[model samples]
Target: MEIEIATIGGFEEVGRQMTAVRAGEDVVVFDMGLNLSQVLIHDNVETEQMHSLDLIDMGAIPDDRVMSDLEGDVQAIVPTHGHLDHIGAISKLAHRYNAPVVATPYTIELVKQQVKGENKFSVDNDLVKMDAGGTMSIGPQCELEFVNVSHSVIDAINPVLHTPEGSVVYGLDKRIDHNPVIGDPIDMERFREIGREDNGVLCYIEDCTNAGHKGRTPSESVARTHLKDTLQSIEDYDGGIVATTFSSHIARVKSLVEFAEEIGRKPVLLGRSMEKYSGTAERLDFVEFPGDLGMYGHRKSVDRTFKRIMKEGKEKFLPVVTGHQGEPRAMLTRMARGETPFELDDGDKVIFSARVIPEPTNEGQRYQAERLLKMQGARIYDEIHVSGHLREEGHYQMLDALQPQHVIPGHQDLQGFAPYVDLAESQGYAVGRDLHVTRNGNMITLVE
Candidate 1:
């Protein structure tokens, strides 16, 4: 059998992730993602209301034009997680392929919510639910399994596609976390078993997002410690405390809520995305949200909640809002710009529980948000978080454990790919032979 894989997106850049694997006539596509930087850059333009093709042309969604020929051959559209960059484009693009979208339960529900919320586009494709550690048949000769992996977002998985040729592991944006707070730890034994199979893993399409950095990615528990230390230091402050982070980070949000409760403050989750993700976690029993915790889903409701908090006593409540990356429309950014009902006092703290993604648009928006908050005399505490992607040491651990026949460094540009190649080479994997480095729209074919 001859197996071929195409890097539709996320091979040369950080966003707009989609990859296609072809075993015989069956094709499976993974991660129809959005380029948030591009989306934010083009926000408010007429193109915002355009179709998927237009959005792809504008660089907001994946370039599925590369898979136009195999649209009918697609077996499933699988998303590895719930991150917008992983599942955001499904509403716009999944309808093109007449295949069921198979994903974790949280991801499926989140996609449903996104589709219902996106008035401009609708997906007619079937939505199938799968959980971590579940297996399903995508084709007569292709079996897919979701191996649980730890990441910033909940329900992230490392998908392994077993074909007649061999098993291919899609291991993007994952880190080995032994001490996760919300989910189970990384399944190293499963990966090791796959590596020891006779056919084993033919190609390991791995995440290299942070491969340029050294050392293992810190566990989420470390982040919890950091957050506790920072928030506890300000427990005695009479002013208000406002925090912002990725809404999909349920573990971090849980930690924030617990800390707020411990400090004798009511935790209020504000913003639509915040409600969407945290509410999902609640329904799925992943996290037991405090019953008294106030959550506002709409703009009007958020404004009302903020006003009530202001009227009651801002110091008595901890407000967690969206816009850690400082999207102009997000609640935190609106608060920073004085567009919201809340005020930032001279000593009020704004805790950023996320690291800046370092994309050009993110850097600009974060910089502007911080500047405005500074103008309002708000104290800022940023980078009080850990990355979801693996660092060099974690990558080394994964490579040694998986022991695939070939390795493909993904989710990085030429500069980002350099250190990834160095690490893989250090593992005795040769370039252009056992280890391959390619860009988007390129194909890597293996015959068995």
Candidate 2:
């Protein structure tokens, strides 16, 4: 049997993650994602109006012309989670393939939503839902399995491809979170089991997003506790307070809503993405919120809600909004710019439950948003969050658990892969031998 892997995208940057693994006559692709930073860098760029090739030229979507190099039938197009960087390009590219889009239920729903809003392409790919602990046949000699993992988003999985040559485990975008707030823990137990199962993991692809950082990434519960403490400390303040985070982070949003009530404030979710993700989660029964918890997405409804919050007195509510990274059109930026009905007074608090994404564009935008908020006399509370990726020690732990024959560093550029390479070398894996450092649109043949 011949086995090969393609590093399609996201090898040169933090977003637009797409990879394909070909096992003999069958191929399975993982994550047809969009480079959100690439799209956001341009002003007034409507992705809906743009074509895939044009977006690919702008580095917004994966240039999948390299797929022709792999001679196999694509059996499945799997997205590990619903994050934009993982599933954003599905509507644009999935229609080009003849495979079914297989994913966990939440991710499948998210894909449907993305496909719904797309107008340029007709994505008529079949959708298949599988649980985290489920398995399906890829071809005559291979199987696909999904292992539960902890990430910033809910219902994330690490997909493993089983073949006669060996097992190829796609370990992208996860942390060793044992006590993740909303879902099951990072299934290190299953990973250890897979390491000892059958051919014992031929190639292990890793997410190196935080490999340079020391120690392990903290559990989501730690951030929840920090949020509780922060809100409790400011309990007595009789002024408006606002908080923001990744709307896809259902656990963090639930924590904020809980703590807001604990501090005698009615927490209301405001913003389009916030309403979309939270509403989906609630409808899917992944979470339950207070009966009266308001989630307004449309401009008119959000504006109406803001008016209600203002009319009911700013001190009575906690607005958990969008724009954690200060995206120009997000609700928090609009609030900071004083374009919303909500007013900021001296000593008013603004809590950032997300760390600044380490990109020049995001840094600049966040700085400008903070300056605007501060100018409005809002006290900024920042960095009250934890990363969704594994740190140095966590990488050490994963290496010990998987113990694969080959290792591949992914989800970061060459410089980002450097720290992980050093860390892998410390564990006795060399750069050009068993350890492979690769880039986008490249292929590695493990067997032939």
Candidate 3:
């Protein structure tokens, strides 16, 4: 048996993540994602309409070609997590391959929610939900194993595929968070066991997002302290207290919710993305926010909710809305632009519980929003956020644990993946033979 690996996307750049592994006649695809930077740069498409390939072509999705060669031989489409950069392209592109989409429960639910609004391209692919530590056979030559791992989201795992030729592990987005606020810590023992098993890892595709950053990533606990400190310094105000962050960031959301509760206020969530992701986390039994929290998906519904909350007053509620990156269509941008019914009052708190994504459009849009909020006399609290990816020391630990024959860097460009190459070399792994740095559209074949 022989194995061939190809980078359909997410090789030379950061988003539109797709990778294909072909063993014999069957091929398994991992992560059909969107390039948020490319999307904004080329198409000028709204974030909500990014699922369409036409808009994607205009720059919303990565420019790499989908694996048309595996259209019929595709066995499964596995998404490692729920981030938009991983599963966003599946509903739009997976149907062509006619394969089952496999993921942890929350990732599946989140993907379903994303495609639900698109009448033209509703998600109809077969869904197989495998819990962490579970294994599922896909074909005669391959079995997929979900190894429980920790990330910003619950039920995130590393996908280990046992193939006829050898085993391949996909470690796209993971962190060794010893103190993850919402879920259990990383399963180091399980990873070690897998490494020792027969057909032990032939190739390990790993995330390179934090390869350049030094040391282990700071835990969610550190972020919680920062949030608490920021809140304590602010005086109580009469206007709405709004906070915007990554929807899948359950730990950050939990911190905000707890802070709101401490201040004698109810936390109200707004926007469909926020509600859907939060619901997925709750359904997966990750965290339990209060049942009284409100979420508005439609404009009409949001307008009504805003009116009710305005009458009830700011002291009664803490509003958590979308548009942390200042996407124009997101709820926070609409409110900042005076498009939403929600009113901004003097000395009101608007906490940006996220970092500004460095893409040019995101920076511009966020700048506009900050100016508007300031003009309205709102007090802005920015940069109360933490990264979820593992840094250099964490990557070294994973490399030490899963000492595979070869390492293929993923999720970032050459500059981002360089550190991984350096790390492997320091461990005596040769650059060309044992270390493979791939680009989009390139393929690597392993022979035994």
Candidate that would win on lDDT: 2
Better model by TM-score: candidate 2 vs candidate 3: 2
* Residues 192-282 of candidate 1: C-alpha lDDT, one tens digit per residue: 9888776888889988889988888999999999999999999999889999989999999999999998888899999999998999889
Give one clash count per candidate, in the order shown. Answer: 0, 0, 3
Candidate with better TM-score, 1 vs 2: 2
- Candidate 3 per-residue lDDT over residues 1-448, each given as its tens digit: 7688888778877778889988777788889887776665544455555455574555545443546653338888899998888987776776676788989888888778766755556568888888888898767758888888878777798888887656888998888877878777788888887777786778889889888888888877888988887766663654578889987788888888888887777888888778777777777777897787776677788778888888888668788888888877789988988887778988888999888865567899899889988888888999897777889998888888887887899988888788888988998888789899988888787763
Instruction: Name the candidate that leads on TM-score.
Output: 2
lDDT of each: 0.88, 0.94, 0.80
| Poorly placed runs, candidate 2 (over 4 Å) | none
TM-score of 1: 0.97
Model 3, total clashes: 3
Question: Residue 415 error for model 1, in Å?
Answer: 1.3
Rank by TM-score, descending? 2, 1, 3
Candidate 3 segments exceeding 4 Å error: 41-56, 62-72, 121-123, 235-239
Error of 2 at 120 (Å): 0.4
Per-residue lDDT over 125-217 for candidate 2, one digit per residue giving the tens place of the 0 to 100 score: 999999999999998999999999999999999999999977999999899998888989888999999999888989999999999999999
Model 3 worst lDDT window (10 residues): 63-72
